[model samples]
Target: MINDIALGPQNREVKQYLSRSTRDSVLGDLGKVLAPQIKGRGTLQSTFDKHCIKDSSSHRKYWTEESFFNHVRGSYSTNVISGATIALLWKSFYFYAYHPFPLDLHRDAQIDFDAFIRATLLIVSQCDELLGTRELDWYWRQDTAFFRKASFVRMFRSIAAPDHKSRSQQQVDMTSSLSDAMDVLVMIGPQFMHAMPSEPQLESVARKLFVEGPPVAGGQVVRREDLSALIRLLLRLRLKERIWGTRCHFGNLVEAESGEEYLTEVLVDTLTGDNSGQIVTFQQLTGAIDLIPNLLLRFQQLWAVLFQPSDAIDKTKPQVNEMELNSIGGIVSLFVPPIDDDSAGILRFNQRDTRLTLEATTQVSPDSLDTSMSRLSRGISDDSSAYVVIFTDDASTSNTVIGAFFPIPSKTTHMIFQIQPRFRILRWEKTELSRLNLIKPDAKASLSEFAASEGSLSSNNAPYWIGNPLEQGAGLWVDPNKGTATLINTVGGCYTEMPSVGGTSNTGENWDVTIQQARMHIFTVRGSGDRKG
Candidate 1:
């Protein structure tokens, strides 16, 4: 993540992270099209994709520019950018998926010079992985979390020597950097109000920030090159206080569960390239992490725990609940308090169609089918809230669940990717926005007539389920009221190719008839705190 050519944190005339020459060179071919700051979305119209990348739209609705600015008032710039989080900064920065964001974020807008520089750096830096600008990735399809944390470091530098732009490195004072650190923290917080620490504690965190780089002037000041690194480390330490709304030390979360340990061990070994084909000792895991020059900028984006303290704190073990750790392919879903014995997870798929995945929850039991699936059906059938469909397979090696999530609910009779409820052709993972949203077919077509079928392709209402009904392009479907379901993928290209999902070829595999898939489960994914389906 370090820039070899423009390694001057003291040279404040250029971009903090990306050297000006590098920023300009990267944007040369693109010209002004990918400019960083733009007027606004309405201006962009249809060419919005050129501006913002929208791989996944988890937010059902959007807050107006006015409303959004209000939410991040202190931290976000409001005047020059003027409700321009996406326009000015986001393109070059990492859009945090710490929460759901607006779906209509991409807009046709204009761009400015600094904005352009940031955008170009963002695209060029990770050009090997993500192609262009994009929204927050909920599923993390491409391992990009903390992907650009380094960029933040570049923007921030020597708060001790705050005046990086006007003065030369030789003239700058680095030991005095602590002056602006508090202001930056306050800007990023409603911080740990309940866990407010004493002034000495904050100073300690700030002073220790300059961990790397050579000490300047008889060790009294830190080097300019290390200033950006300090900003990045500071963010990792503080930003979560804003998002998670609780002060967390590693000890609190780790004591609770296996968590991402299996996932952690797997990725760390990949980072360390130790692939010993044996268990990873704790020393090896930590050592591998330490060897990486920049923990935040690893190409794999594989580093899991970024901000562990040098010393342990909070030795008390908080009361923790059992949670199900489900992982498959590049996806990992944790059901806190654990999913019920009956319900499986949810899986939504496809784009731009009325079709959405039918969902299942970790709440409720499959054995009580009479009330479960029926109520889920009635819920979507009646309530007009957004919903998501979660599809899971028990047979897969890694137990990965596939889904497309859209929390917004619509009225049109959209198509559905079959996943069943707590029980229906396994509860066709879906929400009944309006009376099944099914187009009645002329006369009763055979099960082979899926496209023109009399009702939805799959439903958790029981009887016949397709898709999760477990089949390939079939017209007929049947659920035996048992714990199993069979699907035949004859039309082809039905399943996504995931080796962890037992996918053999680069292309999708077929059900080929003998499919005895496991029973369906259900759970609700909402902040309402109710886990019931």
Candidate 2:
């Protein structure tokens, strides 16, 4: 025998008891204060109210037509929504719109919560135009009543609003979208090695990211408009699937109303991998995509062992601003990555966050790049977060470098030790960005320093944090006053290469580039050790 779930009269008592227990556990001292009267003294009855069972007004299973339409912005009146409008919310509420309607009944059709949700899953992910007719036939055979309901809804809406046909028809045409015809092929671009989505297909779906580019050049080289569009879409998809977290996590990244835009610009700039103001070659696009996994954008992590209402803004406020929603702790997010194995070594007590800005300089910090690490981190409430240091260069040179120091900050020594990430040094020779990290034990110095001496960065009474460079190790030394960086360390240590690069420092295999003009930035990660409450 299967167990019932608060249904039937038999299991009703169990559900009522469960609900009472749940309420008692959460009510704390308040439960005692207002206990008797609310609980009812004589012959109290349990009600299976929809509001009582669900927390959200628009919960997929619990919502009525009226509540759900109001929950979704732009959904407008209940049962007055079109498929195109529902499609717009697919990213945020895919589950809500994909379970009710599963076929192309009619474009101008007015749909209830049931039809929109079913149609969504069918259109976006599971769509296979090759099998369309057969599947429709199968679905019609499976549920003839469902088809009848859909047809009646469409017929009624058409009769009520005669003008809907012209307006809705132009909103989503085959030429403007990846729909109705040959499906499942719009996303698999050439970079992923699937059948490359046609240029027409790309222009149809992702033309927004394009910058009104020049005419087509020739083979392999596409119009500036097309390349930009393709790159942005690829970057957006990878980030949605890889770097950015769930819709629930988006609110935490914001510091202000424009916080999401600030973070989005940072993410988009980082993925572009080019700021020379030139069209990124096909090679650059692929290289940037390949680098996504290794390119980690992190910050000093904030850990909350317990949650409190005051810790977040007053969510109950009648008009909760964008900053308050989708938030954790006090800070609302724009796009925060999930905490997982990829976070860092040391468990970090916190991790690191590094981002790019809109200007040529990918180095601008959200805060300011002051002289002292402690001073830079002074304003950050969460002790485990990273320091911000932005450095922008001109259009002449090409390299962009971002680095952070990870470890629990020592109040005693005031020193920062390298823990999670190995050293990363990037060189922009012309129009490309390349990286070099020295992790192998055999990585020794290649004598590129003529005016400078050899050894390592000083561990003496320096005010800010510095990595203790090995005699054979490499390090990036930033001199804020000069706005220039040396090929190898001019003060002490010389530059070394990654061990995986296959040649030794003394073997004459080289990496560092001498820049005529340069700017530097250093972001140090400080753990909230004594600060962790």
Candidate 3:
């Protein structure tokens, strides 16, 4: 009747074969042979030879006791039982003896708890055979012995070692063991949560495994140092599966895309939500933060190896040097925000302009100045106009202003653009005039002529004022004699040589020629582009 309950569509054929009288008889006989070994009264070798070895009448003459033993020890042996046969036997045993199968069997037959325990013991005793045969389901079920105090430590050690297994086989065993461990935790998690406060034994085991350390076997000593190593091993296995394999478990909560993502989600949820119910401490929280840099460094090292540049020096060498490691360490250190202090220099200039340097020294707070003035007593010597530009610390240009000190004359006024809060004048340079016609015969007509025509300077200075020089769009023109010429279409802002009525050469009623100095460009502008006025 129990066999009537289907395992799945995939197992239908195996289920039918298992239900046959002949196969059932064989399984019963196999159980009889294993019962002695499970009870510790008989050897595993004798049990294996009785159940696993083929009859002499059969054509399989290679299935000898010695050959089966070699296969169990992870040696290459073609005489071992087929994987399908092993799976069928394991499922039959689980259904018949392991009382409460992990999945419901929908059977009315009473379960024999003693028989189930013995069956599990037998399975664990033959773990080597199961692992070598890649019987993952059976291996997983046997890990339930983790609850048995006498066997848990031994199981832990067994899972930790791969011995002579190949890399691929080792990975399979580690993943299977990890999954089983998580399943055991899930099975016990609810009971532990409900009774942990009152149960000292459970609490003691928890503290030993997670907090303190596991008890060492065959000695009175407890190994505290092995805690991290054990955790590292588990993490490495979980990470390998999540990173390279398609599916993996994150505790018993949910399947995750990757271990990294699972970790990130857990950390975010733990920190962001009300965690009064969670078993976390302040020390543990800070300890996790402290581990970030180290984790990042390790990840960087792995990434460097995984995604190494094709053109890297010494392509044959896979090892990273100390300098490279330190570089990665430095990158990891950036996770912590650096301390800010006013005592340290805020800005440093590697290259300096003598003129701006002179101006910086004269002002009490040159750095705080909103606007700077530079008086060009003789105006620009060349035909090109100068430009002052400010740049943020990130090297992006923040502000640009045409240098107004142009059209050689007795004196010219230039006003620097307002310096923004976090920006500084990076450089200034001579830029070609956007409007070369600013000095053309018609454009350069005297302000006196305009004043005479307009009746008074006060009535209308707009007619004599030249607006943005690059209004027509300026660009660079290559000249054979002069390397390049920056041409502009208009004069910089408005300018007039006409002195105020009651003003001296230095001071005026509304305009000062001497004291009210204009800021000149601090750096040179090179290359070519159109300057639109």
Candidate 4:
């Protein structure tokens, strides 16, 4: 009873017209062209609007003088601001590297320009290790250099070379230049953390700030070998400011190359409990002791380019502890090893409990002398590394304190956060065998052949189990004649998922037996049939 309405081939004219309409509609909507002419003209135009400037004056003949003047100023302002923003982005990355996770969660203004420079240098050092290139080459690749020199397109081009050079070399050159730029920045970053007195107030402050004693005697200066000295000095300054809850002001210095000056600021505060802006309280400072070295080392490298001394000339004795690690920031003196070695054996500064307790008492407990003294004795009795920490107080002035903890184990590797349970790793011997073929498993080896395995003991020369019954994580059917293992889980007409004679789908599943024993039994039965007497 059904009548068929058969469709015929479409008319060439109608078909062509429909296709042309669809093509045009799509092209118009997406701002593209039909196939074979699919140039991204629309995308290019959008990019031009955001990044390029094409004004009325460039096209028109009747441009006014006022309009021309405004354009020149506008461009200059844009370039300066953009360059600074690029520097800020580098600073953010520096902070992120140390605190891969929120070590100071819900903390604000944790990073400053000094920290930023140190972070960049750390990245360069890591890159150097991975690629065997100069430490500076890791920063300042063409892409990164452009970002640092944003709004100055030509500056980037000047750094990039077309021939006889690799990207690494170009990066090294740029980093060296950038380091010089950062030294000027470090001089001024601490000012933002606190306010300085006016010229009238400086007279009173100057006495307290100036050297009060015959300072630590000078030592032979080994310039290149003493990078740690300079780095430690900066760290001390940073820590001192944090501990005292004070602000530092270093006046404006012009950038060596640009000769342009900009204001810089650095701030540090600690917070406790739920409060956002409050100083971090004493109780909250407990775990921070472990972080001191990591923090100092990380920041030093990040901003290494910025702080490197500009002088090439070597001065033999530039005053040892001239830039004392402890005095610069609100940092308290801790043991730096190899201070002097006159004894039968080296008597280095060790971070013992007593030292930390004594240091803590001097800084924190002005009234609780008895308790502080007890703490010092008790602290020294225990054996652990001691660290000086800066702590903030809500009702009182900032205090520096010391903490003691056993050294972190060597085998421990840090994850970003506590996402895994702590476990002691068992160590084993390793060897550098010549032939990689030694890595291949012998056809005769079984699970028990491995030293640590607990399965049924396999003999030294026992042949490996072959055929379906022994195929792990899969069901197997035995081959009565030519015995050899074949995979059972593959999907095809040849493979089956049906229950075996043991009433289980595979060695992985068992009606009653344990999975491990089940696998072992299967292998044993299949492998030993011919060898059994």
- Tens digit of per-residue lDDT, candidate 2, span 11-82: 443233222332113122122221221211121111112112243665533333333234332212323333
Taking all chains together, each candidate's TM-score versus the true structure is: 0.30, 0.30, 0.16, 0.17
On residues 213-311, what C-alpha lDDT tens digit does candidate 1 reach at each position?
Answer: 223221122222232222222222211111110112122111112222343433333322333432222212222221222222221121101212212
Ten-residue region with minimum lDDT total, candidate 2: 299-308
lDDT, candidate 3, residue 188?
Answer: 24
Candidate 1 segments exceeding 4 Å error: 1-376, 379-462, 466-480, 486-505, 512-517, 527-533
TM-score of 1: 0.30
Scanning candidate 3 in windows of ten residues, the lowest lDDT window is: 349-358
What's the true lDDT of residue 184 in model 2? 19
Top candidate when judged by lDDT against the true structure? 1
Please identify model 3 stretches exceeding 4 Å from their true place. 1-199, 204-243, 246-326, 329-533
Residues 7-88, model 3: lDDT tens digits = 3442443334333323224324334433433322333234333334344685332233233234323411223223432322
